[model samples]
Target: MLDTQGRNEPDTLNSDTPEQDLPALDIPKHERRVQTVIQDLPVETLCGRISRGALILQPEFQRNFVWNSTKASRLIESLLLNIPIPVVYVAEAAGGKQDVVDGQQRLTSISAFVAGTFPGPSGQKRDFKLSGLQVLNELNGKRFSDLDSATQNLILEATLRVIVIKAESHPDVKFEVFERLNLGAEKLNDQELRNCVYRGRYNTLLAQISQYKPFLDIQGLSAPHNRMADRQLILRFFALQRLTHLHYRGNMKQVMNRELEDHRDPSDAALKHLEELFTRSIDMAWAVFGPRAFRRYQPGTATQPDGMWEERLNFALWDTLLYTFSFYQKSDIIPNADRIYEEFLDVMTYDATFAEYVTSTGDKADRVRYRADTWRRRMDAVVGPPRSDSRTFSRKLKKALFEADSSCAICSQQIQTLDDAEVDHIVHYWRGGQTIPENARLTHRYCNRARGGRED
Candidate 1:
């Protein structure tokens, strides 16, 4: 039977093969150093550590505190009744600090009660009061302070079982533990788990770029507050960029995890380049398609306009467009923006073959490559083919325009500003010219127009 997350639960093993007939399952000794210790600590001790910041209840990896006062009260009631609670998983960081990987809601509720505050409807901190207690009806609507000393001591002295994954354990092992433990109850989304597993420069960069205004505007998101969905989209762009050739053979989650692991500690220069690349691509998309950047466009209907676009964001379209813009030059992209936008709409409307790539489950590596390649080819038909050395030309153009203040090659006049300049092929495209920096020059738009597709 499928679980809540749609994953199938394992069936009972009814194998007839003897143990000697089974194949050996081997794991490298060096990779098996996962050390975990179980301890039962008093609730007062855990709360004191949280208050002192020694126990990190809320790490960047954890979701926001979402437990309501009623739920908190239920947990408190359970504790007071001496019921067996689930063991919480914690990872030991350096210098004796502990990060609570699982059981955040339970721990946070405990901490909040100890601190005498609970978040109200408006998210303001208010006095913590237990309510909606069915078994413990007498204790309903009572705050911790209102409890008798014996009852308070019962809560404070309650021991919670914690599974501590030691600092010396492999990081991947810890991530696996976190993932397996939380897969059923209070499960984290894939990106949330990724944020915890891949905590480094690249992860930080993805979080930063996901909040860029153009990205937020295109996704119709006001803020990066939706379960890290925007951040996940940003991560998809980078991951698919790396796996564009469809080399990966696993699921989408595996692809994302591998990509994050590969880029966990990217250099500052690389991070800055990625930031610029994503920002420029997003800006270009905004300039071309406006609010309909990633939305699917339906052709005119009897009741709808000539181009009826869906308000909901389409991830398939987003990934295809992001891959296209991310891998192509902005100068090349800007010239055919209108055509690209129109053709994308037409492709979505008329091309049934392309539709399957996006409409169905497109997480397969081949599907990803197919959709990206199909859209890329369509865009190329409008923008001209991307050169193998296009990145070199892009860097050169930036240096020429921004660093050197280069002038127009056609008119031999100073190109005063970026808005006034355009990077052009010194040898026109129709005349067998390559789109390389050596064959390119910064020219005023009017000057470039003055050339008028001339071979010379």
Candidate 2:
């Protein structure tokens, strides 16, 4: 009902109020409706778009696909059996690219089945045979190619509804609308949203590396994190490596988001190198610290490492400890476990710098830098000073050293190439040796780590 000024009255909810017609909601005319275009595109056309990269079948972030071949095959059978399936929701981005926001499983499975390769138990894509069809029992065990010509046409020509949320519907708005529509569904996190914002191989690497076994074993998990927590941790590792040298400043979340945006599409080699770095560093961390890898240590019990670590994981300590580990190779760190673990425990158990910064204001730039610095300094005191881009010998000095004797000082073997040669401190850095050329000797990267700070 309109009031005296023509303003609509709020609807009354009094239990005693008599039933009456209520005015419809008066939404502002300028408010934009979700501009969407619907198409009943044939399965073949949809698959073609996916293959051509015009339509993205996978969401930008890696989804833990719950559909096994059995589930995927059922989707195919439904298509062939003429059973109606749900519509695929695509968000049309600028440049005419369409990203799948919903129905990823159905579309991805159909495309994979048609292509003859589907994700197997090990994550490798392999050719699959159809199975578990209730009605088409005779069609079970048949590959896509095994189907007769008429059946193949039936599969390809089947129409699937495609709902395109026009590019004008911003990504943020799309997410909010989707969540509002899917009320009671799980909420999305930053990393999950990044998977949509940043579409490329780097995002895939985040998903893949988050499942590294040693890290999971340390965390006491049998599977990858269903939430993107592990992925964020992995991302922080890479982002810090990039930002640390620049003396990073900003909110951690913004830093991570910018990093993802900057390197959305990294080269395969770059991804592989990062994989090795994480694998090697995490393996050494697991070897040295065991289950107590990243938790606060203080208890006196046998259930945890050093009889003192709590069950909770510490994010600050995780990056700080792993940064120290990254300075040395896993091969050398394994043998030095006794010293490294003892030092790490001393820091975790007693050092104020390590304890204070990590427990509170942990994400502060100063705290982050000092926590890592404190661990690195302690580690260097035991293992010796490491090669530094800023503190190391000049290129001229390095050349003179190699020319004087092109042999590894530690291994006492001929150095094959300049790329494989690294200058070592004759008197360990912690033992008061200067980074001067007189104290430096060229050695292979492998030999230097294996030497483990011992005097020649």
Candidate 3:
């Protein structure tokens, strides 16, 4: 999801996914719920709802309140002057709670001003004083508290016509309406919509995993902000894994929806297992490639030996590497970290199959398949076929292999001592070689590492 310049900065909450995965414009009328109601709420009553939790301002639905003192003062000026403000829109959530769909900045500005705390100097909240009034210069330097009783009553009783879309509305319908109505800078992307629509244990897991240090370090993003872009990426990883067996809908949103529905309320045991895999894969990814993880590269020349590293995060590459790494624990991948990294670079550089078409048609299942399968086969070659076998053979097997053969099976060299000797798999552990004594041999640890495993 990086640009050509390789500057995939996560400073904003907006996702860089090229596709818009929201529902279609023409949904069936029978499935739609677009009822709405209007309430003329006074400023004081509305602010009290915010205080008592009857109203909610979800960050995922909009951007942070960024109005300055001058702008806020203008709003207060309008209230004092009785100028009709713009209509506010809200969605009726469960428990009769209203979520602000639009007008967050205006609402927050009113709330902040009435509370005597406006966004002031040095990013700190301080008592708001009326300033920068073009026509109301006479009212300058007056806080809300400084107002006379009649003026205070006017400010508190200022009417705001709020249109609340009822809770019966479908999520996609709500999302569709909000897309048009929302005038905020941070529009709800797919994941943000999912975060709003699917509030459950699995969604909570996505938020949790996105903050993981290795995951954040690799992504170069600090946390899940207003848009929940990182949360989307986290969802992609787990969702795609589930889709490995399920039918593939080419549409990404449908794919994500299925995944969320499948595990909306996962058991503690299930969450624990998935979490282990996520953390382990992330740890292995960071350990193996470091900053180069999920980045692209150009093939190297004979002189260069290793090609140039392109600092970009390709989502397709991210899917392949992270998903493949998830199958094994960190202990499985850590031993051959250097080898894995170098060989992976070579694959990206020399092999066109793995490197090509990562952007244009990358989301296709076949494209994901060959790339992941290639890397996985390479892993099997390097770290051995995943037979749940431990690297450490028992002491009895080590001694028996040593006693059975005084010479190393790999190099046919004489064993010096057991301290320097290591149990090497004869058939190569990577090639489905088991840990049985028949397949065991003694060799110098140096020889084993440098050049040991063989095929018969």
- Per-candidate TM-scores read 0.68, 0.57, 0.71
Which is better, 1 or 3, measured by TM-score? 3
Preferred candidate (TM-score higher): 1 or 2: 1
Query: Clash number for model 3?
Result: 1
Q: Give the TM-score of candidate 1.
A: 0.68
lDDT of 1 by residue, 1-456 (tens): 112222322210111122343332223569666788999999999999998989998766667788889999999999999998788888886468888888888999987887889965445899899988999989887888999999999999999999988877755555567667765775665667777766667877877787898777776666664456667777777777777745645355556667787788799898988888788778778877988887766667678657766776666777788778887655666667788878888898778867776665435556667777788788878877764543224654655664575677777778777777777776665334567767877878788777786422
Runs in model 2 deviating more than 4 A are: 1-38, 51-83, 91-99, 112-157, 165-193, 204-229, 238-255, 266-291, 298-307, 319-392, 398-423, 428-433, 442-456
Model 3 Cα lDDT, one tens digit per residue, 78-112: 99899999988887765677778778788888988
Provide the lDDT at 163 for model 3.
96
Q: Rank the candidates by TM-score, best first.
A: 3, 1, 2
Name the weakest run of 10 consecutive residues (lDDT summed) in model 2.
9-18
Model 3 misplaced stretches (Cα beyond 4 Å): 1-16, 19-29, 32-35, 58-62, 119-124, 182-207, 220-228, 257-274, 301-306, 349-353, 384-456
Worst 10-residue stretch by lDDT in candidate 3? 3-12
What's the distance in Å from true for residue 219, model 3?
Answer: 3.0
For 33-123, candidate 2 gives per-residue lDDT tens digits of 6668999999999999989999876663646566888899899899888999987777776468987877777888888888888865546
Q: Cα-based RMSD of the predictions, in order?
A: 9.3, 13.1, 9.1
- Residue 82, candidate 1: Cα error in Å is 1.9
